[model samples]
Target chain A: MASITLDTVGKIYPGGTRAVGDVSIDIADGEFIVLVGPSGCGKSTLLRMIAGLESISEGTVRIGDRVVNDVEPADRDIAMVFQNYALYPHMSVRDNLAYGLKNRRTPRAEIDRRVAEAAVILQIGPYLDRKPRALSGGQRQRVAMGRAIVREPAAFLFDEPLSNLDAKLRVTMRLEIKELQRRLRTTSIYVTHDQLEAMTLADRLVVLNAGRIEQIGTPLEVYRKPASTFVAGFIGSPAMNLISRRAVPHLPVAAQAGTIGIRPEDLSVAPDGPIEMEVLAVEELGAQRLVHGQTGGERLTVAMPSDAPLSDRLRLSYRLGSLHLFHPETGRRID
Target chain B: MIENRPGLTLLAHLVLMAGVAIVALPVWVAFVASTHTATDFMSGTIPVWPGPHLVENYARMLDAGVSTSGTPPVGTMMLNSLVMALLIACGKIAISITSAFAIVYFRFPLRQLAFWCIFITLMLPVEVRIVPTFQVVADLGLLNSYAGLSIPLIASATATFLFRQVFLTIPDELTEAARIDGAGPMKFFRDILLPLSRTNIAALFVILFIYGWNQYLWPLLITTSSDYYTVVAGIKRMADAVDGLPQWHLVMATAMLAMLPPVAVVIGMQRLFVKGLVETEK
Candidate 1:
């Protein structure tokens, strides 16, 4: 329903500590944008700024056509689902879903209609009369979603809403949220530290490091061509390996910058390969094996078939197109 | 069951029983005295058994009271005590919860200064500021009223402090959620905060009720009319006979009545506390 535009957004605390730097993102209408990073990288802070929960130190945030820098959170026409669910503990599920509508002074019949619809959509209809304490963690999370769904706001802001659940439930709820967003077609900005969640749920993922935007691209796009060495290392499961260019007896050195990046899956075992490695260990992950070892004083991990031959003394090979080159001075991608 | 420590278990039971006996003995003695006649006490050694005047003395105190002392009936005095206790407990909770909410949620110049000012009142209790407080109450013409008996003692910093601690433990996410849900400050307070802190408020109410009911000097100083006399202070007025020995049996009966309501309130509030703990399913 709305496009969110964060133009040069930054947040600095009173003592001059920068939590987020100059970061800009254009989220198209109904696009699911995810802000993701490790802890203290300001992913949550950026999400909060967009939700109007935190004050922006610099820049303008536009929702639809209006600049909402000074608007109160209540007037901003947005709904947020928190990491802990933040359900009103004493209210019944029905009342929890109705709270926002009632606050907006919607009529009694309309409140009931929306609450019923949200409860059914979240499949929490049986818990409509029960307090949050009587519900399981997964149930509480659904109720939290129900609360947001009832609002039918311009945007949905999720701050790691599935992190508190068990791993299996997190997966289940993640799918539910993705499906719900697709159906509602509501513009959303989600924040998480889990790379898998970011990769699966986002239309575009914004990788953050040290309060600055490292890269922004679609899931497969970022996976195929990362914008920086940080994105190359952060986006993949086994993590891409970055080694000093001097470590290998390279035939064609792209730059004098002295860094090379290759994803674990791209490197394979080849008997006549040029790169010599001494295998330290191997992790058999059912379908694939993560081969960790050393080559010319640099540590590297290679993902190969589980059924493949394994040995202590091994040779590794990767295509020139799959190789990533970076300037050693900066972590930016140079490929 | 803990580590099969039978010796330690037996020692614990003995210590507990001794503690219970030591605490209950005074109330038992008061009960026994109230059941006896005046002649029963003159017999020097205090009787451990109940006498025949149990119903008579209580009924007399409740109905006629100590007529010679010129005070109102004990029934009227007990009602006064109930009103004062209920008002003080409820008023303190209302004032403290709102003040604690404001102090925790809002930021302004002198906010810390305001918190410290409220905290300093814990050191300056009504006992310490008795004279000036009484003067202020008199100047406001609040003497001989229920407000006179309760309001001067209800601005409690301890209750405010307890509520502040409770409010701080609430996650900041809750406030954000309420804001995003379109609840303003007061709406969030009424709909969310008050329900969440029910256990704290209930527990504080029990303590404040006893503190208010047991007040002696403040009520005695402020109330000149018999209509406003609380049970605890009224007992003293009844005990003061110019030239005669105090009516020992009636006085003991009045004392028993004075102690009953507060004990009952404490027990009742404790049940609510337990209920709150059990019903909190998480």
Candidate 2:
């Protein structure tokens, strides 16, 4: 319902430890943006800043037409779902969904209507009377989502809301969340360290590294053409193979000295390929096998069909123009 | 429980029985004394067996009370004790919970200093600063009133610390969630923090009520009127006769009455009290 604009947002703790540096992101209305990074990378910090849960040390965050830099979180018209669900343990699911509306002095009938609607939407109708403690993990998560949904805020903020559930449940909940977002079409910013979750759930992802944004693109766009070595390794599974020019001296260079990147899925078992590698290990992953090996002192991984022929020394090649090259001094990608 | 060790189990049973006997002996003797006539104690030996005057002696204490002592009826004194106990328990809980919430959630200059200041009150027991506190109460014209009896003692370091510990264990996400849900700070405190700490309050109520009921030295020094005498402090006056032998039977009966309410509270709320004590963090 609202476009979020972060113009050079930053967070510096009182002790001078910078948690998040100057980073800007412009999110279109009804966009699903995921801030993904490793631990201590400041993805959560940026999300907190946007949610108004953390004090902004610098810059402005705008939700819709208003610059919400000084606005209270509640006044900023946003709702957040935490990883723990944080359903008031004492309240029933019905009360949890109705709490925000009641605080805003919404009419009693309206509160009931919204609460019932949220319960049905989240498929938590049967549990409306049960306290959060009695509900299962997935159910509690739905209540957490329901709490946000009932608020009808301009945007929704989620901080790794699916990370606490079981892996199987996590996938189901992830799909449910994506489908729900699609239906509601509310602007949302989700933060998580899990790359797979980020890729599957985001309309666009902002990959962070050390308080700085490394790249921002749609999932497929980031996968097909990463902006840096960090994005190259972080986006794809079996991590795009990164080789230093020092290790493979005979590899082609792109007008500069640096590392070269090739995704595992892009590599194939070719008999006449120029790259020669000794297979160090092979992992059978159902339909596809991951072939991990050494190519002239450089570690490489290739995704091949399960029934593909294997040898001690395998020849591998990537399709032309699929290579990603980064500067030697800096990790920035070269055109 | 994990093993069937009969000999060790028997030893444990014997030890437990001995402890129960040792603890129950005083109450048994007091009960036996209340059942006897005043003439029975004149023989210079206390009776162990129950006597026939049990109903008569209790009715006298509850209805007419000891008339010669110039103190009010034991019934009135028991009411005073109950009022004072309830006031102290409720007052301490209110002050401590708010202070604990403020200390834990708000960021103010010298907040740590303020916390350490409250902590210092713990080290200085009321017994250590009785006279100055008594002087303050006297200046405020609170002496001989229920306010005097409870207010000075309501600044509880232990209760504040207990509530602070409980509040600290609550997840930070709950607070943020409340903020995002459009709740102000006080609203969050009332709606979320208060409900979460209900068990802790119940447990602490049991402790503080007993503490307030059993207060002796402060009340003895402050209240000059018979109307303000708590049962626990009044029992002292009953034993210290002006010009005659002390009414031992009536004193024993009053003792039984004074111990009854708090003991009943502990027993009745035993489940919640134990839950409040043990599972406060959860």
Candidate 3:
């Protein structure tokens, strides 16, 4: 319901440990922004700061033009779905969804109406009287989502909410959450360490590393044109392969000493090509085969169609446009 | 599975039987002594089985002039002990739960320092601070009163520490969910924290109740008059009244009477206590 603006936000703990530094982001009303990073990369800490669960050591957090740096979490008009689901173990699902409204002195009829509506949306009507312990992992996650939705807050914050579910459930709940957010049109900020979730769900992905923002762009933009070596290495599955430029030909002489990055899928197993590799391992993942190999003392991985026949003495070729060049010393992109 | 290893199973049963006997020995002795005359008990001539002198012993213990000092009826002493224990138990749990919730859930300055300071009280044995604590109570005009007995001993660091540990096991998501739903700290604690902490409260109730019931030094030091004397202190008076010979049967019966409430509480809540301890670690 409200846009969130984080201005130069930073979190420095008492011992001078910087958890987040000089980060600024503007999320438009109804937009879904994801903060993605590895563990200890401060994505969850950033989300918690926005929720007012953590203090912003410097800069300001504004929700709908009002600075909320000093406001309490309950007064911030935001609901958060935590990674653990965090449902009240003792209360039935109905009570869990209605707890906040009851605390705010919402009318009994209104609370009941909202709880029923949320239960229906979550497809959890039958389990309304059951405690969280009785629900499956996915159902518990939905109830956590329902608890947030029933509040009708100004925004929704999610901190790795789907990470606890199994792979299949994670995918199902991921789409369910996206659809829920679309229908509700509440501004949301989601944090996760999973690149696939970020790539699939985010309107704009904010990649973070070591308490700093690495890049912020549409998932495909970040995937196709990563601004730095860190983004290149961090955004892709099985991670983008990086090798010394000296090992690969067709590069400008000045770029020969730097690092070259290539997506596994961008490499092809050619009958005769510029690079020769010894196949170290082959992983068949249904439609695609991931060939793990070595070329010129550098490890490389290439993804080819499952139909493509490969051997130990396979030769691979990569397109020039698909290559990402980075300065080895600075780890920054070079043209 | 249990029947697969007979030798190991027999050893387990032997250990369990030893535990049961060790636990039951005092209760059995107290019951047998309560059923006999003091002369038969002291002479060690009473039968190991039940006796016909139960009613006589009960009458003697309950009589107003049972002791030469004319101590109040034994029943009154028992009632006083029960009342004090209940009050202290409830009071300690209430304070501990609230304090634990505050320390765990709320963001206030000096929160960690406050928690550690409160927790350090567990290390300060009651014997070390008895004189100063009694002086403070006297200054507050709570001497020889139930308020003195309940209030001073009720600020339990152990209970607060235990509750805080229990509270930490609760997923912050639940509290966050409650907050986003618009519940403030008090509402969150009352509706969410308290309900989830049932097992902990039950466990702490048994612990604090026993501590209050078995209290001797504090009550003995605080209350000079027999009117305010608790069961333990009154038992000591009974011991002195018998010219230091101490009627073993009456003393044992009084001890057994004092043990009943806590034993009942423990037996009733043992399941929760075990579960609570296990969950607290998670």
Best-matching candidate per lDDT: 2
Cα lDDT of model 3 by residue, A22-68, tens digit: 99999999999999998999999999999988888999999998999
Q: What is the C-alpha RMSD of each candidate to the true structure, in Å?
A: 1.8, 1.6, 3.3
Candidate 1 per-residue C-alpha lDDT over B72-105 given as tens digits, one digit per residue, 9 for 90 to 100:
8899999999999999999999999989998999
- Give the clash total for candidate 3: 1
Chain A TM-score of model 2 comes to 0.98
Model 1 chain A: lowest-lDDT 10 consecutive positions: A249-258
Question: Chain B in candidate 3 has what TM-score?
Answer: 0.90
Cα lDDT for residue B188, candidate 3: 74
User: What digit string (tens of lDDT, one per residue) describes model 1 on residues A1-335?
Assistant: 79999999999999999999999999999999999899999999998898899998999999999999899998888899999999888789898889888989999999998888987898999999998989999999999988988888899999999999999999998999999999999999999999999999999999999999999999999888888888888998999998988898563667655678889888888998878889999898999999999998999999999999999989878875888878888867775
For candidate 1 chain B, which ten residues in a row score worst on lDDT? B273-282
CAPRI classification of candidate 1: medium
Which one wins by lDDT: 1 or 2?
A: 2
Q: How many angstroms is residue A227 displaced in model 1 relative to the true structure, after the best TM-score fit?
A: 1.0
> Over all chains combined, what TM-score does candidate 1 have?
0.97
